[model samples]
Target: MDIESLAPVVDSILEAAETRGGGGDRLSVSPHSFPDAVEAAAADGRVPVIAEIKPTSPTTTGERTEDSVVLAEQMVEGGATALSVLTEPSHFGGSPEALDRVREAVEVPVLRKDFILREEQLDTVAADMVLLIARFLNDLDRMVDAARERGFQVLVETHTATEVEAAIEAGADIVGVNNRDLTKLEVDLETFEEVAPTVPEDVLLVAESGIGSQRDVERMQAAGADALLVGSAIMDGDVTANTRRLVTTEGHDT
Candidate 1:
């Protein structure tokens, strides 16, 4: 979008990621920890599933749930590889306590899902990964190094080809191409089609937003996405059924 203004966001996020991830090689998970989700989706049987916690967007901050920790538990028990806690207060009704509660409930990697504008918030948490949009920052390498140094996985969310290239060049291993256009509040399946194939085969692609049905996951999988990060839809539906729908689009009873 607006590179000049957004560069700061990216730069600041990278600074935090590097300070945390430390100067280490890419991290891997034991396949034994994952359920059917990551195990089945693994390429030649590898890569962990990034099970993200569905968070309330800041725009809809007032419409919040009373017990997000329970939801996190359900997601893990229902078969998620990791947990993502939304900690942004302005848009998502997420709090540090919710993240801590979920982290205590499960033994999986928990990611802090916030705007991630600064490093202080990250320093105060015990998360294993951080989420950042590629289009919002300028110093991608610095941010990624920061996260990797902390032993925290960095998920670079991209919305366009330029961002994807920038992310990869900056040493990003996992990238998410969001189908939701924040400005217009719309879903363009074309976004998946356009960005998925171009990504380096090694970089895991995660399809986010506008996924209301299993067919969306199927479509993304076909387009080469390794996993799907969904929210709202599952929260808006019967918990178990929705979990089943996302975990296995093939109608397997969960």
Candidate 2:
């Protein structure tokens, strides 16, 4: 495992987190809006919006319009309810600082969007929410424990029923159905189908990847999705226009 091939950047992020410390005790802040954003969305029967700050992706065309930090500010200004800042360095051109910048710029909950590895990554004061991809769910226990221990929330991702089993075993309350395969980058709109049935009754469902149309959003909502992890569709495209459309329509109860 050439941890250096990818893990060092994550290590550096961990070091940065050690420098800032977590935001108080978990039990003390458990009732706060950040960790409970998903629950709140689910309770209100609304669609939570996760603005993924990806510069570019193999599955999608085009690239970021500007620096991720700047783009994150732009997303917030455009009415994003929550921000998902990519912290992966190589493929996504993201950094802990980008997460930090977005968290610093906006009051809405900010999620550290990346392939999380170890407990330390969750302890890093980068963002309030952490993304746990299901393909790697086998290792999710320690990481999820760390996040919960630090009063952070986890968004476990699943691409199939197998991964869904892993997420449920690990007690993930927020699940993401990724439309893109990490290794192959193939996309399908119905990626959530396999995991939808297996999702815990209380867990919040999130639709990820190929969410480009409003109709697509509606369908996911019907499937019990409380949030959408929209990335390339919003990040590298006509950001303002798409963001305006999505944000306005978010929280479906309106």
Candidate 3:
């Protein structure tokens, strides 16, 4: 798989950071344990769906039914084991402020999903966990180490067998198999089906993207996904119902 360039987004974030004079108040520290919560949720015979708080995407535009905080509460109440907040503002219509609000409102672990490229970004992250895409990083090991040192659970995103290997080699605690092709922004559920079995039993496996129905959740569960990170589908519909649909698939064999 060809690696997609996230430099545009990274550059924009850097420019904004520079213009802000580099050093604002950091996100308040939290002692909430994301990995432990996720592991416990999975151990309890639930699919452990990680509901996402995404207001918009680069491919579409519309107002979300409720604010991030409101949605966060709904997801947790609906049976979401965790949360994934889009923190990339330019393309994904997300921001640190949104993450902060959601994090404050929910008790579950929050995954900060963004095109993270530097240690400083991790330093300021308000979520309990951080995403590091293996496709975008040249030094995956270093980035993983940096995030780990900051007391953040690392969710390494992988798109292929090679990337999965890189994620494992980098010591990823949670490995996310993203079905969407970053270059073209298209999705095929088979991507997760093909990649999930390659993940080790020790590392938590999460299927991300293109999950629209209970059948999709069952398929991922059958494919060995321990958890799921669903965004657009959950964001577009009833958060509670969508989350319940996914979580209720826990007893299936993937």
Best by TM-score: 3
Which regions of candidate 1 deviate over 4 angstroms? 1-37, 40-52, 58-64, 252-254
* Deviation (Å) of 91 in candidate 3: 1.3
Better of 1 and 3 by lDDT: 3
lDDT of model number 1: 0.65
Clashing pairs in 3: 221-254, 222-253, 222-254, 223-254
Provide the overall lDDT of each model, using Cα atoms, as 2-decimal numbers. 0.65, 0.67, 0.78
Candidate 2 off by > 4 Å: 1-46, 123-125, 250-254
Question: Per-residue error at 179 for model 3, in Å?
Answer: 0.4
Worst 10 residues of 3 by lDDT: 19-28
The alpha-carbon lDDT assigned to residue 17 of candidate 1 equals: 43
Please provide, for model 3 over 15-120, each residue's C-alpha lDDT reduced to its tens digit, 9 standing for 90 to 100. Answer: 4544332114443355477667867877876778889888887645685847889889888888888998887766577878888888888788898888776666
Provide backbone clash counts, one per model: 20, 0, 4
Best by lDDT: 3
